[model samples]
Target: MSKALLVIDVQNEYFTGKLPIFNRDASLKNILKAIEYANTNGIKVILIKHIIPSPEAPVFAVHSYGAEIKQEVAEQPHNLIIEKHLPGSFTGTPLEEWLRSNQIDTLTICGYMTHMCCDTTSRQAVHLGFKVEFLSDATGTLDLSNKAGTIDANTLHETILIVQASRFADVLTTEAWCQL
Candidate 1:
């Protein structure tokens, strides 16, 4: 099965901006490792960037510092770079078409905000008939508090991973995926 590593929204917003990723060091390390492994194994590496159109936006505004891909990831040799405005990478983007054109049947997902972009992209992949592997340790989120309730980073991350494993994707650690 052909595979592409989808590095979703590993941007400055999560690292140096408003939304700080929990376990940033660990997750970033695993993400870089995953990319290196994919490169060595001939798997395609795709980097996704998220942008908020409004210039007044608090984070990820277009052409803003927070909207830029992290320097480490940006320096990596990637097959493609996609800009997305929504949580799901495939939404209003050429991601599905690109995957199909390249004959990629499997997507391995890793990036910031486990419960947001990562989860959404995994579900979108499943719906588009592609097999998905979610890198559990390489994706992360920060503590969230809203009208619903408050949840810590670890719990939010685990909950999303569990949900993804149930039906959307095969969730595994970065090391396990590398060994495969």
Candidate 2:
């Protein structure tokens, strides 16, 4: 299957900004490794950036440092870069057209906030008739607490992985994906 690596939201917002990702160091390492592998091979690499339109936004404000992709990820070789305003990368973005035009039938997902953008993107990819492989260790999230309940980073991350593996995508680690 023709493949493309979707590196989503590896932005400064998850590092120096308000939202700090859990296990970021390890996640970033794996993401970089995946990108390197994708580049070395013929797999297309696409970088996804998240931006909040409002300047007063708490995170990922447009033209803000937080909205910019992290240096390590930004420097990596990629075929294209897409900026998304919502949780799903395909929402209001040209991701689907680009994927189709490139004949990318298999999408390998990596990058930040496993439960949010990663999960949404994976499901969206499946719905659009594309096979999705989610990188377990290469995606991350921080502890979250809402009016409903609280969940630790590990729990939140694992829960998403389980759900993804259930149907939406093939959940696997970066090393395992590299070996494929």
Candidate 3:
């Protein structure tokens, strides 16, 4: 299968910034490993950065360090770096056109905020008829306590993976995906 790796929102905002991700170190390591593997092979690597358009935004303001890709990921040799405004990478971005131009039918996704950007991208990929391989351990989410009740980070991460596996994507650990 023709494949590409989408590393979504691996930004300082989710790591060392305001919204720190759960298991930040572990997930960062896994994403780095995935990028290395993808680079060593023939797969294209696309890194998506989340940017808040408003200068007065609370976080991820454009030109802020928080909106930039983490140092480790930035040092990697990626094929493309796309800036997105929403949770889904495809929404209001050139991601779809680039994927089609590159003949990418399979997408292996890894990065921060599993319940947000990662999950949205996975579901969008399925809708676009692309096979998705979602790296469970390489994605992360924070604990939440909102109107919809509360859950810990681990539960939220696992639930997103389960939901993706049920229809949207094939959920696998970094090691498992690297094996393939």
Candidate 4:
């Protein structure tokens, strides 16, 4: 099966901007390892960037430092760089077409905000008929509190991994995924 590692939103926004991730160092380490493994194994790699087009955008403004991909991951060679404005990587983007064209049947997902972009992309990949492998430790999320009360980062991240494993994806740790 053809596989591609979709490195979603591994940008400075999560490191230095308004929203920061939980256990960031660990996640970054695993993701960097994953990228190296993929490159060595000849698997395709696509680095995704989420840009919030507004010039005054609080985060992810296009061409801004916040939206720039993490230098550790950015300096590495990749097959493609997709820019998106939504939670799902495929939404309003050439990601799906590119995947299909490249004959990628499986998507290995990792990067920021486990409960948001990672989950969204997983579900959408399943909906679009592509198999998904979600990296648990390679993904991270921050605590969230809103009208629906509060959810800690660990709870949110685990809950989404549970949801993904239930049907949408094959959820595994970074080590397990890398070994596969």
Candidate 1, TM-score vs. the true structure? 0.99
Candidate 4 residues 80-119, lDDT tens each? 9999999999999999999999999999999988999999
Which residue pairs does candidate 3 place in steric collision?
Answer: none
| Overall lDDT per candidate, in order of appearance | 0.95, 0.95, 0.93, 0.94
Which tens-of-lDDT digit does each residue in 1-180 have in candidate 1?
Answer: 899999999999998899999999999999999999999999999999999899999999998999999999999999999999999999999999999999999999999889999999999899889999999999999999999999999999999999999999999999999999
Candidate 2 per-residue lDDT over residues 31-63, each given as its tens digit: 999999999999999999999899999999999
Candidate 3 lDDT over 1-180, as tens digits, reads 799999999999887787979999999999999999999998999999999998778899989988989998999999999999999999999999999999999999999799999999998999999999999999999998899899999999999999999988999999999999
Q: What lDDT score goes with residue 171 in model 4?
A: 91
| Steric overlap count per candidate | 0, 0, 0, 0
For model 4, give the 10-residue run with minimal summed lDDT. Answer: 171-180
Please list the residue runs of candidate 3 whose C-alpha ends up more than 4 Å from where it truly belongs after superposition.
Answer: none
CA error at residue 107 for candidate 3, angstroms: 0.4
Q: What's the lDDT for residue 14 in model 4?
A: 93
Question: What TM-score would you give candidate 3 relative to the actual structure?
Answer: 0.98
Candidate 1 displacement at residue 146 in angstroms: 0.3
